[model samples]
Target: MSDLIFYTNPMSRGRVARWMLEEVGAPYETVVLDYGTTMKGPDYLAINPMGKVPAIVHNGRAVTEGAAIVAYLAEAFPEAGLAPTAAERANYYRWMFFAAGPLEAVTADKALGVAPTADQQRMVGYGSLDHVVDALEGAVKANPYIAGDRFTAADVFVGSHIAWGMQFGTLPQRDAFDAYVARIMGREAAARAREIDDALMPQPVS
Candidate 1:
């Protein structure tokens, strides 16, 4: 068996984890899942009952969810130096969860054309789009990256979302976001992942 096994669909958030795998320079086996067919297979469900993409089996343990997977990989392979010092732990954890929660919520809202009323804003953890965007702006603006100058896995989590948003025209084309993506995408690992996935997309179906 391979040292690592990754379950994913190119069209899903799994792309984020795929980028991270490349970041760590880890050799992994991939099982590409179709929309609804093979992902839910009994064997795959044993790894992730939710049938989610981006789930991984590493060294006999299962890790699921994009954020968790990124964190796990960073910790699992410390040689990559993708995590931060203990002093940076708070921001490290905060941004990862924030991306999965607030970032996802606000981006989804923008995509659906739904604006929250003032009262409704309080009910949501993100509060408002302006609040969420401003928070992201402050973090990246202060440092070249989210978790300070180091290109930690946290950037992979939040950066990928911002990159996707920009690519699809769902996010603003601010210079900060543009520069942030350019920095991350310029990494050799990120480029390798994109190349591999792009090649996979053009292969003939069996």
Candidate 2:
């Protein structure tokens, strides 16, 4: 029996988990869910009560959140070499959650044009989008990967955010982000993941 069951919607954040799965090089089944019905149904909600995409079940256990799934897959499939070393794990975790938390929230806020002001920033977790973007640029520019020279699950999580940020124009263009994304896009595994998800996505009505 297959131990890993991946549940996703091609148009959603599940794309991030899919890329990590490809990097893991593991066999898994994909269960596609819909936004209106299937995803909010009781069965799917059992896996993630939040009714969110990008949930994975492995060894009879379910994991939700794209970042969590990516991190879990790295440990679950150690042979993929996607897990960070002990010494580099701190940085790996720091930047990984940074993307999942601050980067994610700030970008959305920026896109919505409701970002918190400088004084209000302290109360919010992201502390403003500009600070978040500047910090991320520095991190990517200084290190080839979030954890160091090695491409760990951190890259899969954090890197995907950068890719989407740049593509959607939510984040400003930066030489560092561009170079980092170029390197990640060069991987065949990344290519395969993109192909699979793109194929599954529904065509726009317009």
Candidate 3:
């Protein structure tokens, strides 16, 4: 058995971690857990108390959260060169957390029809979905990649959010976002990851 084990459901945010795993090109054992079943079972919940997919267990050490998983794999397998350089570290962390925190918060709020009133904007971390979207657009527009000129683990987390946002109508489609998605999602590793998840998706009953 591979020392690295990935627990995921193809339809979940686990796709982001899967992409990072492919980018690292490391061998990992995949355990597909269905929603509300194995995912919430005692055994899996022990690995991730939140009962979330996209967790990884490496050498018996469990790392949960999609963003952390991406970052962890990048460092764990340095040969892949996915970790940010010293120069790129600032933006690397900045954007990755931005997506995980504000961007994700606002998008989920929007999806659930929970828009905050203007007076409550300050109370919420993201303020508003439009505000988060504008900030994200500027970030991606400023750099070819999230960290800098080269792709890093940050892109796996941030880029996946952007792609998912656009596809699900959580984020507005703009030229900058479109171009940025084209640039990063075009990666061979991204394609491979998508193929893997796509194949795993439940087939429509004919």
Task: List per-candidate RMSD values in Å.
Answer: 1.9, 1.4, 0.7
lDDT of 1 by residue, 72-178 (tens): 99999999999888867878898888889998998899899989899999987889877888888777798887878788999999999889988987677788999
lDDT of 2: 0.90
lDDT of each: 0.88, 0.90, 0.95
Best by lDDT: 3
Identify the runs in model 2 with alpha carbons over 4 angstroms from their true place.
204-206
Return the TM-score for each candidate structure: 0.93, 0.96, 0.98
- Arranged by TM-score with the best first, the candidates are 3, 2, 1
Give candidate 1's TM-score. 0.93
Cα lDDT tens digits for candidate 2, 60-176 = 999998888998999888999888898888999999999989999988988888867778998889887778999998899877888898788898889899999999999999999
What TM-score does structure 3 among the candidates reach? Answer: 0.98
Write candidate 3's Cα lDDT for 86-149 as tens digits.
9999999999999999999999998999989999999998998889999999999998999999
Query: Total clashing residue pairs per candidate?
Result: 0, 0, 0
Q: Which residue pairs collide, candidate 1?
A: none
